[model samples]
Target: MLPDGMTRRDLGWAITGILGVFFAAMISMNVVVTALPVIVSELHGTQIQYSWVVTATLLANASSTPVWGKLADMMSKKTLFQVANVIFFLSSLTAGFAPNMETLIGARFVQGIGLGGLTALAMAILASIVSPRERGRYAGYFGACLATATALGPLVGGITVDTLGWRWCFFVGVPLSLMALVLVGFTLRVPVLEVRGRIDYLGALVLVLTSGALLIWLSFAGTPEFFDWISWESAVLLALAMVLLVFFVMIERRVSNPIIQLRMLVSRTTLLAALSSASIAVCLFGMPAFLGQYFQIGRGLSPTESGMMILPLVLGNLIGTMTTGRLITRYGRWKPYIVVGSLILTCGMFGLATVDSGTPFWFVLTVLVVVGLGFGAQMQNLMLAVQNTVQVTRVGQASALIAFFRVFGGASGTAILGSVMAMQVVGVSVAEVNGTAPSATYADASGTMFLVAACLTLPAVVLNLLIKEVPLRTTI
Candidate 1:
């Protein structure tokens, strides 16, 4: 049931407000994409450092997502969303004024924590107000927010870098966040369920450390300055990550209210959704992180041109999402969309695997459109499928868990693929002899990165085929 006394119009306004916050959070993530090469070169950062800049945020966001979801179940989601917005606002300001890459990375990490809260809270809020059957239509809007923000982020980042400066990329979100804060405060009205639970502090801490260790291992290992992949340091870090993961699993099993409920994942649909989400994330998160470098460093395009180049991808995503969403709601059959979407995504990835600096732009752009269309059809729909299987009261946790895996997968993909790219870069192995530089090396190396990413999506295609789609529930 919708919240008592909440009309459809009220819900629309509330959803609008929620999408605004979601847009701001997502836009902040991508705004630096087009400007990253410039930012890193000016700051004198290495390729590893460049990867860390993006990985840090994804890691922080992934780690904190479960905690935020658990908190929403026990408190007021509207209030939590507002608080996260404020945190994002402050972090963006700090990032804008940062004097060095290290400081900017630190700020982005904190911003990701806030982003975790916003992402989880927005989905929870939607679940609370909309039935799973009806949510299919709204899911399109969520996808639009994601795609639109992604689309605008690069264009805006490009324009900001070309005209005002790259610093303005960080400042751009400030006003949007402030506006979302005000809109949400006035329009959002949802029932806060009275639930009793303790926050899983130890579980959350260990999960963070575990992911951190694994990412750190991926980021620096194999570089000559750091320990090689076969070295003792790699062994130690890998071992530490495994041990902490075991501890985290143990804590979840024993906690009164686990950050991520182990039992919920036992369901076939939920499990498949988690796997599919992670697999899709490999391409969704990993590709764009390097696309900027591919165009600017490899093809020698300006930030603005690179930004404009991606418009087709975003456009395809926008249409696919909005169209698939309405079809799922109208027909009440979601499996076919995902099944077909995954195949298309897989095909698109392979197509991209062949691209290099010298590849024709028309062919690359066509493949991107295909990839976006496939991804859009599955991304939010996977969560919708999972939410259908869970109880209304557990929606917050269920949604958060899927998101956690997606973000974690994205983080892992960024680090692992980044390491793959770094290894391929011409001077990385000989950086001591010749200083690191961003050059045509990225152009030559990008194909291997996309090939690796393409291999990762194969599992997603298989997993989506395995998912048994239960009918979406009509009640919240």
Candidate 2:
């Protein structure tokens, strides 16, 4: 049986609120991209710190996703969703007034907490209302929302930064967040899975510690001066993280109401979907960090121009996501779209690897569109796969797990790729490039990063192949 009053429903205005929640979160993330370099320069933040601005938010998002999902399972999804939005709303306002890198990063961390809830709860609600077979069409709308937000984010950031300075980018999303809250607050209705037990506080502690330690390592490893990958600091942190992970596992095994269910995790469908998400994440997170820099620095474009230049990526993403989502729903199969997405992603990455500052703008745009297309197609399916494999009661945690892996992978990719860019920039400075060395350095670095990123997709494809497609359930 389903929760009372929320069964056999098709999306209505509630879809507006759901998409609004996602759009608000995406706007906040995207709006900051073009403003990042300016924010760093204005704040006198180090390159490491500049990279941390994005990575910090992602880490926080990853860490909090499961907690938020678990809370939705134990409590009211609608209330939890609103709470997350309020956190984002307040934090965005605070972020606009931030005087330094520390304050901005802190605000982003809080914003990420809200974003995590939106991400997890949005999917849970989708799964709760829409059947797996019909979910793809609706999921396509979700993907379109993401693509639209991403497409417009750079434009919004650029226009705001150019007109009102960088701070307004942070502030602009506030009204949208408020709108989402009001819409969802009044319209959203869903049944909560009633479970009796205390929240696994100890599991949360160990999980955070474990995730924190690993993220710290990812944030700093192999960068210019932070910590060497083979250094004692690395060893100590990794060791501690591993031990805590072990402890977290043990704690979950014994907990009466575990936040994460190991049995659910071990299932082939869920496991493979998670693995696929990690690679897709590398693409998703790596793009904003690298391509954002490329347009601004490498291509010698203004923020507005860069934003416009990146629109094709969003277009590609929209096509891929919506096309796959629609096709999957209509045909009642998912594997074909996923495989095609993987191929397209790898092809795009390889094409991007060949690009330099002098490469034709059209070529670059086409390649990015390819990447976006692949990501659009692959991303939601990963979540759908997990949702399909689990029961309704498992929806919240299962959805959270998929999001957690994607964000965690994104955090790792962003940090690692950011470090690579910084290291190459340092290398360029040491060798003395002739003209506009910083931009040249960024160009040289990004080409290689794209090639490396292509390698990341192969494993995800392998995992996707292992995902056995169970027939999608027709009812919620």
Candidate 3:
């Protein structure tokens, strides 16, 4: 039932407002993908900085996600959402005018903090107002918006970079965010209840430290100037990360309101879905980060052309998610879709693993379609399954925990895969110098990156297989 005094029209407007925020956030997250090459070159950045530019944002988003989720369970969701939007707007504007790569990255990190809140809170608010059974259709709408923003990101970013310059890529989201903020202020209405729960400040700190240490280790592991994978630096960093993780676990167990609720993992479904979400993210986030380099640098395509080439993936994502979402709601069957999606995703990753600069455009487009379809079908539905297991009161925590895993995995995987590609490029360069290879290109290294992604994704298929399908709950 609708809350007292709430009408369906109110709900529709609220959803529109929510989607606007989501659309703007997604655009900010993805607009840099195609433009990173130009951005790095103009700022005189190295390969490591190229990856960190993306990694920094993912790390910030992942680290802050649980806290945002926890807060939604305690505070006014509407107020928190606006606060996040404002943060995103201000940070995006700062990033647009940044004169150096370091400043851009710092701004991106702050931007990520806002993205984290918007991401976790959107689902929490939806759960507060809609039942899981009905949520599937709305989730489909969310997925469509996501696919659209994701689709437009590369194209718009390419055009912006090609014509107006790279700075405009960041500026484009400012107005969109402002529009969302205004719409949400006028339309979004949820009861502010008198909930009492302490924020887990200590746990949040330990979690950030742990994730930061691990990412640092991954990003610089084999870079000769920094340290080797097996050197003393790696050992110290890894040990520190592990110790912090242990502390984080201990803190969570004792805290009144832990950032991540350990109790949720005890559920078999939640555990598997979390694992699968993390695994799937390695490909979902990693592919776009590298594909621009593959098309532009390796294959000698312009940013505009690369953006046009990526259309198949986004189109497939739109088709897959929209189709499966409605099907799940209609037939009340979700597990089969997830399992099948996992298989398709795995196959696509393996197929991409074989691609090189010389690969035919048609073959690349076909594989991208498969990959997009797999991701679209799997991403939101996993959250839907987890949200089904929790009551409305705890939905924020449950939903955010799953999002944490997804972003965490994406950050880690991006760091590792980016390092792998960087190292591969170095090796190929050396081989070219010694006359052992004819060329050194990101196209060659990209195959190795996708191979690693495929290996990581292999586990998700098994994890999803073990998830027990539960009937969708009918009431809030």
Q: Candidate 1 clashing pairs?
A: none
| lDDT per residue (tens digit) for residues 238-260 in model 2 | 99999999999999999888878
Backbone collision tally, model 3: 0
lDDT of 1 by residue, 237-289 (tens): 99999999999999999989899989988999999999889888976666776
Model 3 lDDT tens row, 1-476: 77666788888888888898799898887788889888887787777888888899899999999988888888888899899899889999999999998999999999999999998999888888888888899889988888888888888888888899989998887777888787778777776654686788999999999999999999999976578999999999999999999999999999888888899999999999999999998766667868877887777777777788888888888998899889988988899888889999999989999988789989999999999898888999999999999877788889889989999899889999978977887643321222122233777888888999988888888998999999998897
Rate residue 303 of model 3 by lDDT: 75
lDDT of 1 at 269: 91
What's the distance in Å from true for residue 407, model 1?
Answer: 0.5
Q: Each model's TM-score, in the order given? A: 0.96, 0.95, 0.96
Q: Where does candidate 3 have its weakest 10-residue lDDT segment?
A: 429-438
lDDT of each: 0.86, 0.82, 0.86
Clashing pairs in 3: none
Of candidate 1, the 10-residue stretch with the lowest lDDT total is: 429-438
